[model samples]
Target: MTYSLLNLAFLVPAAVLALVATLRVPHRRRFLRGLGLTLLVVLVLTAIFDNVMIGIGLVAYEREHLSGVFIGIAPIEDFSYAVFAAVVLPSLWSLLRPSRRRPRAHA
Candidate 1:
């Protein structure tokens, strides 16, 4: 399978997991804002580091596996890992943590 299709295999599930976590997570607006910021930083770092690696020949793509899309010689497929990390980590935390809602008191 091509790299893009391979990435879709994992990304789709992670996206679903993130959506479910969002529902469980309180403070919806805050969570979304944090998620956005995390994604921005992770993607930016990936772009910079990936380009450096590809440029220095420390990394290489088969070209046939790639979709021919690139950011500074780093294949677009390389960025999927960054996206996955950014989405999945916070989501898993939200899912695993106990709910803050307290039990109701009986009068």
Candidate 2:
């Protein structure tokens, strides 16, 4: 298939949201840096998973009408899923942690 301009449009918003979320972590900037490092790890894992699936005949590509990018057996669009999951996972994990609000004393 010809590259979908519509599909390609998604990357801008995804990257913007990742940037915004990473910048909003209260005073824990170091945590955000570590989160970015973690995201790299997650991206690698997802790419490997997708590669294995494609290798085992679990997924197939329509090569004749395909978009022009590939990573080994995986398509370029496929890797974006990995990037998206990596960026989102840390933001979601931070939300699950308890907040640091101090207890108020009785008046």
**Root-mean-square deviation (CA) per prediction:** 1.5, 3.0
Write the residue-wise lDDT of candidate 2 on 21-53 in tens digits.
666667567766777787778767867888899
TM-scores for all predictions = 0.92, 0.68
Regions of model 2 farther than 4 Å from truth: 1-10, 64-66, 95-98
Candidate 2's TM-score reads 0.68
Global lDDT of each candidate: 0.93, 0.70
Query: Per-residue error at 72 for model 1, in Å?
Result: 0.9
Worst 10 residues of 2 by lDDT: 1-10
